[model samples]
Target: MRALTHLRSLLGSILEKKGAAWPDKATIEPPKDKQFGDMACNVAMLTAGKLGMKPRDLAEVLKSELLAADPALSKVEVAGPGFLNVTFAPAFWQKTVEEVLEVKHCFGKFNLGRGRKVQVEFVSANPTGPLHIGHGRGAAVGDCVARILRAMDYEVSTEYYINDAGRQMRLLGESIWVRCLELLKKPVTYPEDWYKGEYIIDLARELLTLKGSALCDLPPAEGQDICYEYGMKSILDGIKKDLADFRVEHQVWFSEKSLVAAGAVERTLEDLKSRGLAYEDDGAAWMDTTRYGDDKNRVLRKSTGELTYFASDIAYHADKYARGFNTVVDIWGADHHGYVPRMKAAVQALGRDADDLKVILVQLVNLLRGGEQIAMSTRAGQFETLADVCAEVGVDAARFMFLSRKSDSHLDFDLDLVKQQSMDNPVYYVQYAHARICSLFAKAAERGVAMPECSPALLARLDTPEDLDLMRLMEQYPDTLANAAQTLSPHVVSFYLRELAGLLHRYYSANPVLAASDEDLMRARMLMLAAVAEVVRSGLELLGVSAPEKM
Candidate 1:
């Protein structure tokens, strides 16, 4: 990262000398082809038109200036008509190990956000049932994204939006009440559309034990209300426990009912009507979502005097903006893909940029066992809960596999494969790399060799290709965190750790640390490996996975 900063500043000064403005689109990154150079830049192409010179000719001028100005650059070549490919001296790369040792756990942190507030609301499933695998994926992604932003110095708050005011809650209560009647040996007509899950019977039994048969003798409406309150509280408590077990925590639990109770929903509708964004037609209130690129206007209130879900959503988001969040992120299931445009339009109607509201849609997970798909249906309640999966595999494996790919891509969570201790399991492979390094330190200490203090003279011994590769990857951590934060993707960190772990595993196998002939060389290798373990641990922490000292 320091190398990148230095290159950007040096290029800006060179452009100043040439009397040309710096181009904002210029980029400096590692070359795809290692033979080209260590780092490649396109400043020449970006600024050539302004300077009235050919790209290759401008590259030549920049190359000459670079070699004269920076002694750290070992080679500067003008390649392929416009690109500047530069390689740094070995000493420059070796200094990265010292930087890691000096900072330790703070190695990858940055001040990119400058204390901007961000709100990430995720896995806000209605409390009608337990969480299934689809919700698990959203939970992993949302929590990891929040963690990545926090590492970049963003002030982040995570929330769970409770849909407790909707018909779903009413149905949950009726389902439990019917089951309670059956438990009391009373003849009841169970609706075909009611929720069917063993958990409903369990909740009925719990309510019966607490309130006794008196609950069954009450009026149907009164019994349903009592059942609704008890069911919502019990199910929500279980959801909290399951999420905590998955290492996901929410700072706020916002209730949709609260919006209606506080008259926020009515106030929001009035605000829209004042702006001419709302109009009544056919005895119903409508929002002109078409004004902001929606295909059709959206309904805010029905003719029956009942507010639609969109009305409450508008009020909820208005409250979010009023809370001073610079950005609001919503994580939803892939089934909600069609709702994205309408929600964006609603945000625009509220006088905010559509980009200020970010939505991440997580695709479904196909649970498998030995290459066979396991069927799941949330409404029928014939599904595997998140707690079940964690109990079988583990919290670490579940979280890692949930983040193994982009949130929009479908994931096959093979239960048996994740439990294996072989290299086929990604979590095991990365954790083993850290464990192996810790073992190496233990072996060295037994033979009376303590880790050497990191110094320029000592690190000069780490000139092997393996040592430099590890250092290069470690130097890219801060950049990886920044990219993940900007793109709102935590899968980037998962991919980075796998690559870093692969390099470290190969290095561990081919090189000898304690058995080396030279004492200083052994000490140098030990220090480098220690730095690598630190980076591996840091990356795994970002993914909410554990780094064990032993497998």
Candidate 2:
């Protein structure tokens, strides 16, 4: 990040001297091959035509000026048509390691967000059922995104939107009541659309255990109400426990019922009506979401005097804005991708920016056992829950696998592969790199060798290609983090760790650390290894995975 800033500053100064406008910052990048240089710039290529100079000639002038501006720049060469290849002195590279030590755990953090309030609402699955594998993917992706945003300096709020006021909860109540009647050997007719999962039966048994046979004698309507309250609390509590076990946490558990009780839905409807964004249609209220790019107008309230889910959602989003968040992000399943436009329209209707509400769609997960897809256990008669997957593969492996792919792509989760301890498993590979470094420190302590103090002279002793290569990779971390945060993608971090681990493994294989013939060389290598281990620990923490000292 500092390299790019210095390059841009140089270009800005040169442009000012020539009374020309500064160019875009995006044009600067490192060369494809490390052999080319430490950094490269195309500013001369961008501004040469306006300056009435050939690109190559202009690059030569900028190269000389860059070399003269800072002693840290060892060499600046003109490459290709107009690229300025810049290499930092060995002393500069040593100072880079010192900077890493200075920040330590705070390494890779950025100020891109600058403390803007952002709310990320994800895995808000209905509280009527157990969280399945799809919800697991959403939970991992969403939580990692929130952590990365916080690292980027955003004041982030993570939330779970409980759908307690919906029809699903009512059906859940009815399902439990029917199960209760059947358990008592009473005649009962179950609805075709009601839940048939074994969990519903489990809830019914718990309800019976708590209330006894007295609940069986109440009027059907009163009995169902009792079932609804108990079932909702029990199922929601179970959901929270599952999420906690999986390391997915939420700062707030917002309830849909609370919105209705606070009259927020009604107030939002009135606000829309006053803004001329709502209308009466055949004894119902309609929102003109089409005006804001929805495919069609939507019903806000039905003719039966019931608010639609869309209306409740608008109220929920309005409440988010009332809490002073500059941005509201919703991570949803791929099936809800079509719901984005209407929600954005609702945001605008509530006097917020349409772009304030950003939605990310997570695709499906294909769970595999021994390379064959497994829908569910026929004996169990139910699909796998998030807790089940976590229990099978452990929390660290589950999270790394979930975030190993882009959110919108279908992910084939191979149980056999993730459980392996070899380098083929990315989570294992990265964790092994950290453990390798820890072992190195242990051996050093046994040999009475302490970590060398970082200084320009001491670190300059590392002049080999592998040493410089590792330095370049470590320095690229901040840029990689910024890219991931800007794109709202945490998968970049997964890819980064794997590559860094691979490089560390290769470098270790070629260089004998503890057995180096020169004591100074061993100490310098150990200090470098410490930097690598710190970075791996930091990156894994952002993804909410554990970095163990031993495999």
Write candidate 2's Cα lDDT for 168-189 as tens digits.
8888788899999989988898
Off by over 4 Å in 1: none
Q: Pick the candidate with the highest lDDT.
A: 1
- Cα displacement (angstroms), candidate 2, residue 52, comes to 3.4
Per-candidate Cα lDDT values, in order, are 0.93, 0.88
lDDT (Cα) of model 1: 0.93
Report the Cα lDDT for residue 427, model 1: 85
Please give the lDDT score at residue 117 for candidate 1: 97
Q: Name every residue pair that clashes in candidate 1.
A: none
Give the root-mean-square deviation of each candidate in angstroms: 1.1, 2.1
